[model samples]
Target: MTEVGNRHPHGTPCWVSLLARGVEATQEFYGRLFGWEFHPGPSSLGTYVRASLNGKNVAGIGELPRDRPLPIAWTTYFAADDADKTAELVRGCGGTVGVGPLDADDAGRLAIALDPLGAVFGIWQAVHHRGIETSGEPGSPVWNELVTRETSMVATFYSLVFGFETQHVVSTDFDYLTLQLDGRPVGGIHGVGRGLPRDRGAHWMAYFEVADTDAAARQVVQLGGSVLRAPRDSAYGRVATVTDPEGAVFTVIRTEPLPA
Candidate 1:
């Protein structure tokens, strides 16, 4: 198990959460699908619930405010040293701050923003709550990627804001770029393709590791969720895109097992 106790490096994807209207159903669905244990956050946090795997924090789920309804979706958060300063950088880089440079009590400071290409994400400056404690393992987050139509423009925007160095991965069929933070791969940007709805524009997608993609996808259906994309084999792994009962989308992958 990878136990992450300290804050992630700046620009790394530190956290992810689902904001949904059906909070109870969402919790039950994910809890059964991923074997996650849910714990309610401080009452000051409203309806926030932290999801853990084997006693280590993995992700979160929160009630979507009725006054400002949003489509149920998972929001990926990047680590920042100062969310207020990062919000300034986001604006300077042609993005717009949508919410906060606000504090979550003693947990952290955060801001939500829209990238130049319209992808919404968050920046978190950790305090008492460091981000995810277990990653790259079964039932933990393994990757995060932005799928956008304006690939080059979004690439430029994030690079300028987060000091990301792009490592272009040559592919005959896809335009893909890996975002590297201090020489380590943190996330990726993928060009939207013919298969996806162009009207959907750009969005960040999170992926969690699983032992079997097909089995997990089946469980998602059994638990009242929907499979957006059926499981398929890829160079990296077998993957499937799915949405919770409340419609928050994410991916699950079953990669080749690590060497013993």
Candidate 2:
């Protein structure tokens, strides 16, 4: 069971998933990283596997289309009251609908979509499935963000569809827009070629929680994953950017402890 009824001004973000190249490899990597266990599950879609951390439902990883070219990446899902309606809103907001408001067995209705700037995300109408319960913990999702050249359009499109109002600083020189769900910062949008190398296209990156950012970064290198950026302290947490052996980008964050 998932933690339910957590809503925001826009809508509740319920589920998160990933499409992996070597399903077994991803399963092993993430399971080792996050202490999660994977098992075959009954899905309305083709084949689905539920990922559990310490025996609790945490996230999911699925196989991509073997018949076509695709990238291995994590996909974040925002909770929707009606996935089909949200898909319409996405199109109306100038975002493209890549997939469907199709059924995923009894899990819920889902659709793959791109923001106006082409960053991808998903919509989930959870029935039996709620969403990711433990985020900001080692092996679970800590954060998700998107980068785009059209930062203004990204703000307007998401605001129009999901009602997310972005938070940004005017004088900072960086075009960083924080995705606020019901006033709480959920994700962010940044300009391309800023704080990263050129040729890095617009994409969504998920951050996993870790107990020690330094140790995790070392482990990433030891395990053959490339470290794009070493651990650095931010106002939110200490983080490091990394790419998996397959070249999928992600983050590892260790948040600062709150005052007692």
Candidate 3:
């Protein structure tokens, strides 16, 4: 297990990609939610924006082409020393790499990989961009959690590749294992088993910390994002499930109070 304060064996978590049908609407919605500042990314990737709040990159937003059958969603990215190596590790462990070990100019090299149960994630090799520099604080991303049916395999795969330690202990009644690196909880993994809707397949879901759950949910609806679940009290905090304007699903939880 990586002891407390150990540097991330792979690299820091960087760039998060979000899919939005209404790019302009999402830009405004999250702008209100996180107080994020945005700027255009490379001109070739139209409608993709790099998001920062308080001068730190926290997430990203872009338009999803309607031609594709893909669902609207937020896919998180983690930096790797070698994108190719990370892709190999994913395949060796029974996951599928849907996209490339391809380069994105001076920005980085990247590939999209899905776990055996089909939760997609991005492997990033940073060139110009590193990652969200500040986290676990109010108004920034406090945590990311992946939920799936193959809990132990998902845990083992990441542990072997990234050196993340799986804490047998959980944070809330719903949490499975605390995903730790250098001894602090960076994210978590949860087992869906028979708990979720019967037709819902195993997938990765992320949680963004918010100041108020009710307000955020309302903004989601206002911005064209659908509400899958209403705000409710959980053992950990008040949480709600929502889909972005593009149909990418995620959750938000109110942990600490927002600035008044």
Residues 190-226, candidate 3: write the lDDT tens digits: 8867775454466667677787899989988887778
Give lDDT tens digits, candidate 1, residues 118-232. 7899998888878899887789999999998746788988988888999888878778999999899899999866644564668899999999999999999998889999999
State every prediction's TM-score relative to the real structure. Answer: 0.94, 0.89, 0.84
* Candidate 2 lDDT, 1-260, residue by residue in tens: 33235532235555567777777887777666667898875565556688977676767778787896766777778888778999999998798999898977665678999887667788887766677766655787867777677577677888788778888857466778887876788877777545544544567788888998998888877766889889999978999998766677788999888678
What candidate 2 gets wrong by more than 4 Å, as runs, is 1-10, 193-200, 258-260
Q: Poorest 10 consecutive residues of model 3 by lDDT?
A: 1-10
Candidates ranked, most accurate by lDDT first: 1, 2, 3
Top-lDDT structure, candidate number: 1
- Taking every candidate in turn, the Cα RMSD to the unseen true structure, in Å, is 3.2, 2.8, 5.1
lDDT of 2: 0.76
What is each predicted model's overall lDDT from 0 to 1?
0.87, 0.76, 0.74
Candidate 1 at 171: error in angstroms? 2.6
Q: Candidate 3 — what's its lDDT?
A: 0.74
